[model samples]
Target: MTRLDFELQFARGDFLLAATARIEAGVTGICGPSGAGKSTLLALLAGLLKPQSGHLHFDGDTLIDVRAGHFVPPWQRHFGLVFQDGQLFPHLSVRDNLLYGYKRLSPAQRRFELQAVVELLEIGALLARRPAQLSGGERQRVALGRALLYSPRLLLLDEPLSSLDERLKQQILPFLLRVKTETAIPMVYVSHAQAEVDYLADRVLTMADGQLQPSLATRDAASGLARGSAGL
Candidate 1:
């Protein structure tokens, strides 16, 4: 099913982002080199940037329609975003950081419990520590747990593992895979790492010069990765 339908156009200075896409459930990975406007597209989907003219629909719900002068704000969109840097609150303990957004929602709106997310990410031991006290991978895991605890309808991840070393990336990949398999939450993953995208994305798209297109090669790679990882 089409989870997100986008026909978006936005411009800043000389750069113009003209993109149309139908993102289905599961992970849709956006891969492109630097300056390809991948991040901009994510921002638009996150409702952080309003399109000049276009429509964005999530599950048939209109998120934005330029013609109607309608746009949903980021907080109202129910999208959980995890950026490259982890972006945790420096002073907040890991427990508080996870509770930040989770607490914002009324009990009725809460979908994922704190204990489930903590155990899912295996961050129970780190809860008492602050962001500064954790390692890079541990911090990212905490960030992921925080996002999941928000019970977001969609998760947007932008180069989440880019800052980590190869070993750290390996350490975190399984946790991400577990999230995909266990939570079943739809995700839009943006990264320049082809291999990472291939391993995690069910569908692959490429963004370049403000345009989005399917990457056949990446799609094939993803298929292979899925087959290979089935036993794991």
Candidate 2:
């Protein structure tokens, strides 16, 4: 299994984040209350924020080493990010938005095809529309498709369902499960909702005051939850 090993420290004004983790394949959930530095940790892993000290490695490849002055940029990391707001290009049509990163990759690097992703997300009918034309759930689906089209090494989700209503959350959860079981892309899902994490993650870890707590749930429990939530 692919493993992401890190000992990272970063300070932003009064907030200092220090976290160490060994994330293996499958979904590793980070659950905490707001301001617990969950998103901060995801940012560091995604290369959006640089750690002040220590190092990060992915499958034995050094991605960051502050002492060595080595850092990989966000784009170079090939990690797909899906934020709560589904930051799609306002001016681009759904098709264009999904194709943006996909078209940039050479044919040999394209692991997912456009049709398959569109079908997977059930967004084929909305391709001609722009971001402004879609509902919240639709927008998030397009954003997810855009990421999957890039065939990222890891998928980082920062409360992607937080902005949606309960109904929408239910709608999106099944799709997320499909992504997990179908694509087999490793994921780091950060959410404040314990139920959400418990339902989706193979391993769930709690965070508080910028520190990673012990594992809260096992893979068997999560799988049981998934099996029970089939109607979702």
Candidate 3:
């Protein structure tokens, strides 16, 4: 399994984020209240945001080395991101969106079997519909499928279930669990809810005051108050 190691320092206005952690295979949950830099950290990992100074290494491969003036672009990182909003294109049909990233990949680069992912996410029937035609849960499933179809080395999820109702949360949680047990890809899941962390994460990182509180195993999380800033 590939391990991602990052030591990033970034600041915006009065808020400062300086933290370092190693993310392993399986889901590593980043839990904290709002504005705790969870989203910022994920964005840095995905290369959507550059750190003021730091280095990011994946499985010993250098992705970003600030001192060396090296940085990998977001698309080249091969890290898939799913936000709270599905972020699907309104003009595209479900099939088109799922195929969006997959289509860009060269044939040899395609690691995920299209048919397999389609069945895994149960999105085959929704292909004909547009984004507006699908429910919130259905949209998230499609989003997940699209990301997986790209054959990403790592998956980044930022509060993907936050917008869903209780019923939809229950509906989509199984798919997430399946992804955890059924796939080899590693994931970094960001959320403020302890229930989500308990449910989906094999390990947990607590972020507070724009910093990582401690690198604690999930077992320790339940015993203490998960201290941190509010959501962003």
- Which prediction has the highest lDDT against the true structure? 1
Tens digits of lDDT, candidate 2, 38-156: 99999999999999998989988899999999999998888999988999999899999999989888899899999999999999999999999999999999989999999998999
lDDT comparing candidate 2 with the true structure = 0.87
The candidate with the higher lDDT, 1 or 2, is 1
Candidate 3 Cα outliers beyond 4 Å, as residue runs: 215-217, 220-232
Error of 3 at 43 (Å): 0.5
| lDDT for 226 (candidate 2) | 18
Candidate 2 TM-score over all chains jointly: 0.93
Candidate 1: stretches off by over 4 Å: 218-232
Q: What TM-score quantifies how close candidate 3 is to the native fold?
A: 0.91
Ten-residue segment with the worst summed lDDT in candidate 2?
A: 223-232
Model 1 score (lDDT): 0.88
Per-prediction TM-score, please? 0.93, 0.93, 0.91
lDDT of 3 by residue, 131-188 (tens): 9999999999999999999988899999999999989998999999998788877888
| Best of the two (1, 3) by lDDT | 1
